[model samples]
Target: NIINARLRGKPGLFRVALNGERIAAIVPQTDVVAPAKGNDLDAGQNLVVAPFVEPHIHLDATLTAGEPKWNMSGTLFEGIERWSERKEITTHDDIKTRAKKTIGMLVDHGIQHVRTHVDVTDPKLTALKAMVEVRDEVRELIDLQIVAFPQEGIESYANGRALMTEAVAIGADVVGGIPHFENTRDQGVSSVKFLMDLAERTGCLVDVHCDETDDPQSRFLEVLAEEARVRGMGARVTASHTVAMGSYDNAY
Candidate 1:
């Protein structure tokens, strides 16, 4: 399945050729043969790059902004509490509908890849199951990567570890954690280590929601980075939402 297109970049027009899903050739328009009729898309001087990649998103919690209740406190904890209530009444069909609808919106925006975190804290693993279904259903339209995210504290939640393990065993593409939400800093560090070990054993990628709060003392990002370095995971590990890093003391 070869396809040809005239792509626009900073300098000038370029002829890009794709074989199946890979770029087989790229040459300046002047040096390339004119693509046959009906086989090319001349971008007409529009900047053409690879499709967008949404590295971090919450598909399970999306489209439920005001269900059950609103976040009166406007804090992450409040939002989590509200979501807990919302998921209590959410059915499988409801989750699938909202997820597919969101995927449609992403496809419309030229987003061809998405890595969505589906909460696996529930005993039933409802969100994880629904996301797995959606990931397969929308495979033709987008590269959907499902992360088994423990939105709650991994060690803090009694069954968090079990649920996350089940998610990986079933079909999750990545393992996720919320170290900043753990009850204590030590627990946070432990959770990061646990998640990294799970990823290593399962050969899955690691993407943790680390240091998302405004507290400058939230240093779980440091632990995550150090562990990734130690394990040689390199780019396969992604520590997202390091909001607290901006507030850290320069000397420290």
Candidate 2:
């Protein structure tokens, strides 16, 4: 029940209401309000605003800054190499421990949604399994989306195709690929086709690490966009780290 309706001028100054939730019925001179329940805010100095949203993050790779060695080159490839070495040492417990820590940080920052990629090329599938468990563990506080990423390369890595399929079977929400790292252009194109087909088969979203290089010749993003258009999976697909787009000269 609203007790006092106060208007200071001809139009309005400030109006306050109290029902299930207290709200400002009219605009206030200052962007401040009295504190309410559940807020750890000071009485009259706090301001009530909408909740926050953080859409993208890699929970699995986060917080593993340096283990065996550090990324000396400061390049993405160096980071991948460091991660690959680290992945070899990753146990289920290690992934879970780091993922939980990362999620805790996200919650503290008021982030409610996240999209993380788990490397599926590892035969053990430790990272994928751990993230799936973490998703359940933090469901009350955060929404998690896990992508089964063939980080090494779908065809280039041994049994990568099977690993990706198994990841999807085990509840990965998205299928991923790295086309530029494939052995040849044909392999790159085929990987995208294969990933799209897998997404169709498993009903998962598609995200690709495409053309993340400084070379002007990288054109897999066009291929990905074309395939997405043909398959009618436009926004369902996300092409990440297309830094090569800054150098491409040709259209198509």
Candidate that scores best on lDDT: 1
Tens-place lDDT per residue, model 2, 1-252, is: 222223433332232443445564544434334445564223232233334665456677888888778898899889989999988888888888888888888777767878888889898888898999988988998788899998889989999899999999999999999999888889999999999999988889988889988979888998999999998999899999899988877664
Each model's number of backbone clashes?
A: 0, 0
Task: Report clash pairs, candidate 1.
Answer: none
Q: Which candidate is the best by TM-score?
A: 1
What are the Cα lDDT values of the candidates? 0.87, 0.80
Lowest lDDT block of 10, candidate 2: 1-10
TM-score (C-alpha, index-matched) for candidate 1? 0.87
| lDDT per residue (tens digit) for residues 1-252 in model 1 | 122334543465666676776888876654434546887765554556679998888988889998988899999889999998998998898999999989899988889999999988889999989889899999899999999999877899888888889999989999999999989999999999999999999999999999999999999988999999999997899989999988899997
Which stretch of 10 consecutive residues in model 1 shows the poorest summed lDDT? Answer: 1-10
